[model samples]
Target chain A: MLLAKIRGTLVSTQKVETLDGLTFFICEQLDIDGKPLGKYVVAADSVGAGVGEVVLYVTGSCGRYTDTTTNRPCDATIIAIVDMLDVDGKTVYNKTDDA
Target chain B: MLLAKIRGTLVSTQKVETLDGLTFFICEQLDIDGKPLGKYVVAADSVGAGVGEVVLYVTGSCGRYTDTTTNRPCDATIIAIVDMLDVDGKTVYNKTDDA
Candidate 1:
């Protein structure tokens, strides 16, 4: 699993039939310091996260193994909305208190 | 390599020195049909990609291999800005011509 932020949303009217009714979101990976880590990716939005929201993501087959994404042509997914983060014994993020 | 759409961006003020000055973006994986495939991820933005742009991303150790991301804790990165996509024989996206 990895920590990231929702960057944007993608809407495609034409695509594979198996991908119908699914929502996709772009995510920017956050380093331990919460800085933009110079990287980006497209992911399945399973957690209903919006742009600018911090999130947790999964990759590979684990990302494809979900109720909404099972057995599909997907490699990434937003699995959770992160409320806080504690890394190396420090409060990196506190959703309610920080914002 | 995989096909994705840039969703958003992330900015952090504190983090590992190695991760400084890097940009992270949110991404949603796209299926062959150009629909949201119900998956999302955080990727390091190697290219100057913006929201709503289609991009190519790499994963695993390959993602961490770059001038800005070498020897860091990362799993994904956007390697290129996708100008078009053709899967199983179809024009899903053509940047210059499509909106």
Candidate 2:
């Protein structure tokens, strides 16, 4: 799993049928400090995460473990909503701090 | 899918039963020109990719798309062995060139 922030949404009208009804979010990869790393991923929303929300995303086949992605072609999926992030015993991100 | 080079192998004696008989390989992420970027991933071998071979790996739910990874907890899986890599219509890596 990796830390990322929801950047935006992706509305694909012509994706494969297996991806129907799955919501997609644009997530920016974040470093341990919660800073953006300029890399972006389009992840299936399995946890109802909204834009600007910090999330923990799992990639590969783990993305398919959820009901929304089962047997789907998704390679990235947001698995958890992060309320706070602690790295090396330091609180790096707190969702309540968002403005 | 992303390009990567098999670096090493991982043997686990206590992994979940769903992962039994699955071979894991350490893969280094590769750039378009086939240079290692120093990031590593442990991928379940869906294909019989050998060490030092370049492969295309799929992450997240797509990793489970293969028969070997179906219903497994695998997140990254090697899908194909690369015979060559063409970047911008230029040949960057050729398996025949390996000496």
The lDDT of each candidate is 0.70, 0.76
Find the candidate with the highest DockQ and give its number: 2
lDDT of 2 by residue, A1-99 (tens): 988887665433322445668876657789999778966556789998887888999876677788888877567789999998888999888988975
lDDT of 1 at B14: 83
Writing each residue's lDDT as its tens digit, candidate 1 over B8-30 gives 88888888877777788889887
- Interface quality of candidate 2 as DockQ: 0.11
For every model shown, what is its TM-score relative to the native structure?
A: 0.53, 0.54
True contacts kept of 2: 0.22
| CAPRI category for model 2 | incorrect
- Lowest-sum lDDT 10-residue window in model 2 chain A: A9-18
DockQ of 1: 0.04
Give me the runs in candidate 1 sitting further than 4 Å from their true place: B1-99
Q: Relative to the unseen true structure, what is the C-alpha lDDT of residue B78 in candidate 2, on a scale of 0 to 100?
A: 77
